[model samples]
Target chain A: MDGLKKHIEEITPITNEEFDYIKTFFKEKKVKKHQYLLQDGDKVTSEYWIVKGIFRAFHIDKDGKEHILQFALENWWFSDYNAFFSQKESNINIVCMDDAEVLCLTLSGREQLASEFHKMEHFFRMKLTSGYSAQQRRIISLLSNNPKKRYEEFASLYPNIMQKIPKKYIAEYLGVSRETLSRLYSTTSRD
Target chain B: MDGLKKHIEEITPITNEEFDYIKTFFKEKKVKKHQYLLQDGDKVTSEYWIVKGIFRAFHIDKDGKEHILQFALENWWFSDYNAFFSQKESNINIVCMDDAEVLCLTLSGREQLASEFHKMEHFFRMKLTSGYSAQQRRIISLLSNNPKKRYEEFASLYPNIMQKIPKKYIAEYLGVSRETLSRLYSTTSRD
Candidate 1:
């Protein structure tokens, strides 16, 4: 809850009373490594804010190949947003990569908080603005079709996550082969 | 102004007085075909909401190959958002594909408007939510790397834009070769 207050204050400040009220909307959940936070076809009711540990969100195609959508680390937010916002069944799964704790906020709760406090609305908007920009950058990286450049961009953008995520998953996220990512990793390490 | 009001109302309604005040933050501009709205290295001071015609936003690689980032049609917002929000120099170029009109809003203007009215903040947040979701969908599409699926997804998602944009640009946007797109287009046309 302290972390949640800190996260919100990072964008906009709120009084202790406001914080206490806002904290009521969130419920803390603990998850073990390899456990699922969300699975395909489940109705997405809440978006989680990571309090500790890591998670991976991915989609499985008809051929059984998994396409990594995103990786969320501590203090980051994670959800099948399309489903969460629409209150529809999720097409992706979010699985814990490490033993973790997260604070879950339902859509109605989120809307209520935002509508209740202009600062909360501003905070959420700021977070979404950065998320939107990062996604745009990813789109450009993917469109360029330069594996080396993409790997570099990802590493630079999330240096901490770069060190923590498995190389195979990193390869999948970059849309490159494991062998290619291995080569890049070795070359990068040497450099 | 009507379109701008309508766009904002699509998410949240506003009083006429509020709309009048909100409209003051934007200035209208007209652009000619083949003209640039934004160019690489230029400081991005504003984001534009298209009122008429089409535009293409792209990045040029070291090899001078153009990688299409996105296409903007009427009602779509366009900007080197990475630069616009940060008030930094742009890394991409936005060129008008047809004679166009747009309403421009500065960063300060946007921030002030959001802070001045809770409904405006909610409106912007809702817009960003949809934009963020769209970008996430795009990342999954790009990572999948199936040109046929990508083409179909793009066509189905934006049938109007598909018909309006040239094949070459569409191929670039899908990260497929022009020839591959031609084959897909012919097959789809026949079907």
Candidate 2:
């Protein structure tokens, strides 16, 4: 609850009345490791904010290999964003990497909140802007950086993530082969 | 100016005063084929809306190969978005694919518009949402779809783009080799 309060405060100052209204829409859920919050083809009706533990959102490639798109830890949010916003069936699956607690908000609830609070709308808009900019940076990194540099940057950017996830998953996210990642790691270790 | 008016109207209604303020900030510029609107390491102060011909945003890989990140045609906008928003040096390059005419807006001008006109901010927010959704879809497509299917979908989605740009550039954007694209084109042509 403290984490949720802090997250909300970072976005906008929520009035107690507005906070109460928003609170009615959110339900807390606990998920065990390997349990799925969402699966491909599901209608993504809710977005989840992490209260505890680790979660990942990933897609299966044509060869049925999982490509991790995002890893969410405490105070972060995770969802099939494309499906949630577009009202389309999800192409991504979200699974808990460890025992987790999450706060969930349904799409309708979010829309209601936005309509009721202009400040909330502004907060969401800012969030989307930063998210969009980050995505743009990811694309540029994919284009400009070699696998080695990307791996180094990844480790530096999310030091905890490297310890929690497999190297293969990181390779997939970086658009490199596991073999390449292994070679890079060996070379870096030697250096 | 007419295209700009139409583009803005499609997003939101702007008053004469608001329109005048926006118009004052934009300067029309003509770029020769293969010329750059922005280059890597340069500060990206402005974004351009294409009025004629074609422009592309790309990055050079370690192997010195170009990867097309996006293309802009008539009525479309192009920028080193990461640089524009963050006020950092650009990692992406914006190059003219053909003799091009564009209307440009600086970062300060855009901020002014957002601060002065709530409608303008709403319009930009909507654009950002749609763009973010599209990027998510592209990521999914890259992960799930074969080169042939990707090309087919792109052709269907942007028929005008297919006719305007070279196949090689499209192949780069799809993260496929030109030879693979040629094979796909032959199969599609037969069908």
True contacts kept of each: 0.69, 0.44
Task: Residues B1-191, candidate 1: write the lDDT tens digits.
Answer: 89889988888989999998999999999999999999999999999999998999999876788988778889888799878888999989999999999999999999999999999999889988888877777777777667777787788657767668888789878887889988988898788
RMSD in order of candidates: 2.1, 3.0
Q: A44-111 in candidate 2: lDDT tens per residue? A: 88988889988878888778878777677787766888788888899889989899999998878876
Clashing pairs in 1: none
- lDDT per residue as tens, model 2, B19-121: 8778888999999999988998999888888899888888877788787788877877768876788888987788889998999989888767765666666
In model 1, how large is the Cα lDDT of residue A13?
85
Predicted complex 2: DockQ? 0.53
Instruction: Report candidate 2's interface RMSD in Å.
Output: 1.9
**lDDT string, candidate 1, A40-111, tens digits:** 999999999999999999998767889888889888887999888889999899999999999999999999
Interface RMSD values, listed in order for every candidate: 1.1, 1.9
* Displacement of the residue B124 alpha carbon in candidate 1, Å: 0.7
Cα lDDT of candidate 1 equals 0.88
Please give the range of 10 consecutive residues that has the lowest summed lDDT in model 1 chain B. B154-163
Off by over 4 Å in 1: A177-191, B177-191
Best by DockQ: 1
